[model samples]
Target: MRRLSFAIATLLAATAMAPLAIARGPDGPAAPSAPVDKIVDEGTNRSEVMRVAQYLTDVIGARLTNSPGMRQAEDWTQAKFREWGLTNVHKEGFEFGRGWSAKNAGVKMIAPRPLTLIAAPLAWTPGTNGPITGQVVLAPMADEAALDQYKGKLKGKIVLLTEPTDITDATDPDFRRYGDADLDKADTFQLQNGGASANRRPSSASRMAFTAKRDAFLKAEGAIAYATMSSRNGKLVHGQNSQFQVGATPPLPGFEIAAEDYRRLTRLAKMGAAPSLELNSEVSYDDSDTKAYNILADIPGTDAKAGYVMAGAHMDSWAMGDGAADNAAGVSMVMEAARIIKASGIKTKRAIRFALWSGEEQGLLGSMAYVENHVASRPVDPALTGTNRYMNWSKAFPIKPGADHSKLAAYFNLDNGSGKIRGIYTQGNTAVVPIFREWLAPFNSMGATKVATGRTGSTDHVFFDAVGIPAFQFIQDPLDYGSNVHHTDVDTFDHLKPDDMRQGAIILATFLVNAANAPEPLPRLPLASEPKASDGFYAAPGAH
Candidate 1:
């Protein structure tokens, strides 16, 4: 009976120490770098990203950089950060030109037949005052050479920059959910010593100059407006307007007319008939403003001395329709991730910076500026402008890493689409492969289990990766973004799947929190050895 009593006392002692053992996760990173249960449960259960998205896309309207709507979005996001108890909430400024917004420009055919063509104004293009009539003229001035023939002849005329769209038969499905094979292909990665196959991506200054000269000559000729057909078919009217730079004069009105209408106009011009149309696309330009900003907020870490983890998405988007799918989804992702972390009161070793960048649609202008101001500064590579120059180019300027460059643990981006978190792109940082694999472990059921080295482009992450920082863009399902929705009027809230966005927000929150609590900082690729993201795409798999 005395031995049994002793045993009971020992059992009680063991039970008394159990809470300490339970505090540490089994076989997990030291401490709760990113407490999976806390992140996932709170992330998915209380998702605020989509609500932010609805306000940005549905309520505030399209957030074209420098536009009033974009300003409104900035105010709203900052207020949200303040309300969420995030500290260091403010804006950072950079030299920028003017902002532009559009009401609606009425463009329709009035001659050779009364046909109304659906039209959308490009961003910076000024509106044609009142109803201006001009006969359609086929002016394929691709360069200055083509402009010689039309000198003084294009006065008061609508010019078609190129021919009508060549409608190809739709072969593949519009929407796609990537399968295992596709993910496997994307997972493979290796850095080539030289370069890979060329894809005609050179942006030569001479070529640009020639094109610029042509535009100058066209403007000098007093053209009423410019019109072009969509590069892809099915009434997809792709357009851009912000050609006016800081000191440059205002842009001429332009229209991305329906492909069918462009074809009709060209056909009539080919025949003896004359085709005419009315154009009015006025834009609100912010001539007085010389600078723009990115919204910045932070959740102070318990260990402030350990540096920080950063996450951001561009707030600026194409003026066409609402910029929902192209980026409103992404902006919401990071913002929502920040919200989740702050709301859950997740403790971390590192602070988290949530950034909402502007002027992303304008060639990563906002992010690049931010990098120059805060992260690193390098001379502009004229060759880098060319699609062909994306490879085989060395740093043109010495990099002056910013004070915060070393302290920046990593930057994560989300800009693909409203698809669920399928995978991640390591940008050839194999060291991160295993790390991401671990981060994605709990998300396997959500189908975010893959972490590949493939590279996807044309987003703000390029700015981060360009500076030798370990920046990444998630590998999201296509969801017709490339084929149809991106940069089109159809890219609206309708295309977003809430469940997918919610899943993405939750996943992002976990990643951010984990990065903040990581025992070691992420490894960086030497600036010299790191190749362009384009090269990462074209290089043969496993061809180091």
Candidate 2:
């Protein structure tokens, strides 16, 4: 994760001015208020949330952007909102290019001994029509020179593009619990030996050079396909790292075989026993450029004149596993919260908007487009009379200036995983920290404590805050999300904690209700000049 800890510290320091004082009557702590009682007793229906989650994950399967599954999810969501009686319930259509779909995939080592190979296709890559058998070739084209060494010899063959790992020891703990510290140690271990002349490996430079060489090799020789081993154990974890630029030539179809399986073939080849593989996969591609869509729904307030409060979660997932915990959990939380509010018949003073966005796997494109089109001021005429007129007209042309600005009381988001809400990130919005404290008081019994004023990034909240909207993402405990579940085959319903999901729903519902009925809209901090970019923390290469 990136370090917004500095921003968090600043928010806490500023918010400390006014300690949140819980409301009290003349007697003492007053009895539970009507709103609080409503939330405590009837809010966060656990069974309903679990039911919806199962339907989306088990029945609908993976909802990759623009896939049939995503379209099905949209229809289900629209129907769900209508069933919940949400006002203005509909899928706001947007132009999206050809959708991609995966049917069946299989890989096997045929020669030297028959054995199944665990593998899966990368997103948007073309697939083999049927079983295609070919001799295996160890062609580590690490650089241009190495690539030239095997220039004319890779045709009609499965190219093994990575070094075969030494499988001498099978019980190394580093292989079992491969965390960040272990990864750093691995790099240092390599550096200790004078394997390479450079003291430190040039990872970025090496990757760029290797990519170019790989692409050239693939095109020069009509290779059958490209295959690499997943660094993890023997599991077909699907993912992609290529930057498929518009004009650049696409590489041969790519797939990741398990490390153990690849090692077996490599060992057999070293022993002079010719190894071969039969690979087959089905993938559909839409070449036309298409823009992804973001689903938005609103619950109009009883007082139609009030401001808006928003909540969101990225609906798209890496075409890997089922995308259960990485995001489906967060999406379910937001949906369930909206359902509870609408079901409880809470006619809030301010409207609440829920957005389940697509193309989040690309680069926050969906949210960025929404903000730019709806919030940012735009020139009316593309052919303007003068620069001054364009600038002058733009200043007064925000469609709904008040509503688009901080008129949003607050925007809450969930994306960490299916964990209980530990607390809320103030996102440097200091003025509203005390108010959140009061709002969170009712849920203390649910283990929702530790409120901090911090700014976290790599999520959709950044899109809102960039344009001066009061936005925040919650802090939840890391529960096997990073290593085991995230973008892995293990991210399924079994990993979800039912208790955690229910707790998060209750907390989020309460927070939104309080924000909706607050005496005034959440206060906004003065905008700061854009900060310079820095080589910060590690983020998933293609995460939205």
Candidate 3:
């Protein structure tokens, strides 16, 4: 009887210390370093990455910013975060233009041969009122200067928008995983001397101006329709256009034809056949909501004063295939990363926010809006309005930081197709190199090792980095994303590598947790100033 009473007392004492055991010294419920093994097991042994990818790509289909598919994606992703018990799960909206969708599209040759061709309608362009039949005209125009040459002769014609270039043989393998040598080469530091600045193409402003002018000219000339040759060598069609703004809706219908088929039409035209074609582009516009949304959810931190760390992937894609490799893969990984972190039951000192950005295909509009609204602000040039404001906003001076500018501890992005996480691009933030090295060490055996100091632009991270925030993109394997997929009709769910996606999610979760618990926020780059011309060259219009 005496021993039994002592055992009951001991049990009561142990039960009283349970709360103390979980407390980790003013940091949070979890240890200072994230539990990497737990993350890996959750990400791998029971992965939901593929399921998420399938739903986003196969079920949701192409997500062109404010399109119906994109709206569905936003709702579905928010539902997922709430299901996972993530806090602050809501969408932030910004002023976007119109949404577009292709109901049905087809192009067929009627005269030379009754052969149907692979084609897709360009986004934000009008559809043919109905089926329009016209003779094909090879009126290749590169700029507005060339538009005058075909001014009055294009009536009742389907104009070939670009000249056919000689198809080149593939030099590198279409599908490739990085070898040790490739990773080593990528590790070399790049100089910021801006060597390629001397050979600049026309600014985006000029290019857009030409696009507006050319579209007006074609419509004024009574052209029935227009088609552009695919830039890719394979018989893939990517329906890409940038006329989504409210006042910038293109007047005439446009389509992108497979390269081989385009070349055949060009050859027939050169041979004096004048291959007659029939086009039917049934599309619609949705102006019900001119605002595109960014999906945001958070795992609340123990210390609100400690800033938040973030992970993001663009949820919007071009209107082509399912947008799997180009972005849905990345989106799945980010979502899975958040799931893994929440499921691991680890509490961080600072919050961890997951963002699924929209309008990324339309010049990183969603992320740029986030930076401008929450993190920092720079005065936009009054002269550079419209799309030019987003394109060249980095050129503006004196960045004005917002209330939460310093509260963003660090941001990591993943958008380079469905390749495995090889490593990370440091984006020239030398101070964070060693910190990333420590966080990435746990996954070294999983093939994520290198930390490159190169700058990769054109993704959602550009605007954040431009504002001196510690933002970065991962280095992924160069799987056919550049060769055949990316913006092509073949960027479907079949191309995503499941193993790579799982590894990427595990790595992303580890980084976010580690950054959240770190004693200090990641170092920031020096605030940007007006850059001097590298070669005394001025590419902007009217610059002397």
Candidate 4:
């Protein structure tokens, strides 16, 4: 394994740019830093990172929470950790709802003219057994009043829940660029109605209601299945446009049909031609609730009693695509970083933990559980009284606190995309900005200059930060992720950039090494005394 050469050059260049008091060669005063050999070495290679990423994305495919693929991913990751000589390699499991997986799916139109349709089953959706044809109906339950109109009417029909979007060539240049203003404006643009009521976009609440009603109608009126048109043109894009069925019963077989086919069906239905079709699928769940597992591995520090530093990335992904860009890249990057550190054989003062979290797509559930159960100094059942048997056991033996980290150092996270890490987000922890600048200095030649003071949401790091842990998430170039690969069928192994991943791994590994060896831990902000729950975090408009 060959470490990144660019990283070394970048660090030297950054050192030249900054004015520092250092000793002259052999006989001068001691330099301000430790030897470079102790920071990084030539063992971290790009080939290995790419190989691991390929295995995860191309071999395992989509890893939706507790799906079979997710289990495979967990096993594979644990094996890799052990191979890397990491300690404390194990799976920390927690109970979650049983999730559904699709083996195969297909859609087609046999009416007026034959045409095959591109379709995918929504997560946790029930599948139709074999093929059954039915008339397609334009059922836009727009509002409560509109829903009332269809109280007992949709029976044995395919309901099209989405509205049609007016096709136009209006593209915003500002939106094409990456910046805060562009993001803000892009969000605002999504909320604007394009002059139609029945074509109004649906919200999360509306989608939930629609799912419930569709399922109820299917059960009562004997409907064969349900279908919705993909809103983003006729492209076979990927994303979970369905509701999260935690402990609820599975709904009727449902899928998102191609936009073109849906348009044809809607037009025919409007002309009283009653568009009908058949649907069939196979969906089942394991007997146990879906178990969310966090892959925990650590590189032991030379000082057995030193505090710990950590780096992480979510291992779970949306059910639609292979999840290459949305998170597989991040997972691979962090894992590669750890491998690099271990291969370099650098001894540090603080232990470094690498966590690959599951259930990130389902509201950061995995990280939240870990923090609540293992990070906080609280018991699971706080209601038990002192006289209770569960409590008396503590008197027999002192009840120790959870993973105490008043000595905890810092946590680094990467999840933006497959792009090279551009900089670090302090997440309002301004006191640590100068330290990150020093850490990032070594990567300036790799195009990682910007150091913004903004805060970011929608990733696993939020869990640690909420509980007073000094955590940070890196910033990266967009790299067509949002528009092309993110949560889309195009999110495959090919979308990943090996050079980018290599650069990220080296930078991350070097930073962790430096942080671990630093004389003092990175500065911390006032403890996050008020931790916000993940519920409703992404509920606001334009929230990811």
Deviating ranges (above 4 Å) for candidate 2: 1-34, 44-47, 93-96, 141-146, 164-213, 234-236, 241-251, 267-273, 286-289, 377-403, 531-544
lDDT by residue for model 1 (383-439), tens:
343222323223434667897788888889999889988989998888788778877
Which candidate ranks first by lDDT, i.e. highest? 3
Each candidate structure's TM-score, on Cα atoms with residue i matched to residue i, is 0.87, 0.76, 0.91, 0.81
Which residues of candidate 4, in runs, are more than 4 Å off?
1-47, 168-210, 239-247, 377-402, 529-544
The positional error of residue 479 in candidate 1, measured at the CA in angstroms, is 0.9
lDDT of 4 by residue, 1-544 (tens): 4434665545544554565423222345432433333333332322377888899999999998888899899999999999989999999986666766877777776665666777777777766777767777777755445665665667777777676555566363311325555333322212112213212333344445565765675567655677777755536546374344455664577788766667777888888876666566676665365567999999999887778888999998878779998788999989988887887677788899999998777667677667767765333244322112122211121223357556568889989888877787777776766666666665666677666677776787875775567888888877777666777677898878777777787778877876777666777765432222343235777767
Badly placed stretches (over 4 Å) of model 1 are 1-29, 192-201, 204-208, 381-394, 529-544
In the order shown, the candidates' Cα RMSDs to the true structure are: 8.8, 11.3, 8.2, 9.1
Candidates 3 and 4 compared by TM-score, better number: 3
Q: What C-alpha lDDT does candidate 2 achieve relative to the native structure?
A: 0.66
- Model 2 C-alpha lDDT per residue in residues 1-544, reported as the tens digit of each score: 2222332233334434534334433356432222654443344322366667777788887877777787788788878877887767765544434567678888899898898888777666677888898988888765666777887898888888878776455453321322344223322211112212222333443564567667666867988887887766646475554333333434666777777888787778678788999988888765464546677788887676787888888887776677788688888888888887777777678899888877666556566556666664333454322122212232223233323674576788889888767677776666666666666665555555555666676787766775567888887766777656777766788877766776676677777776776656777765433222423445697966
User: What is each predicted model's overall lDDT from 0 to 1?
Assistant: 0.75, 0.66, 0.85, 0.69
| Number of the top-ranking candidate, with TM-score as the measure | 3
- Clashes (N, CA, C under 3 Å) per candidate: 11, 2, 0, 10
Position 238, candidate 1: lDDT: 53
The pairs that clash in candidate 4 are: 2-44, 97-290, 128-281, 132-278, 133-277, 134-276, 134-277, 135-276, 136-275, 405-408
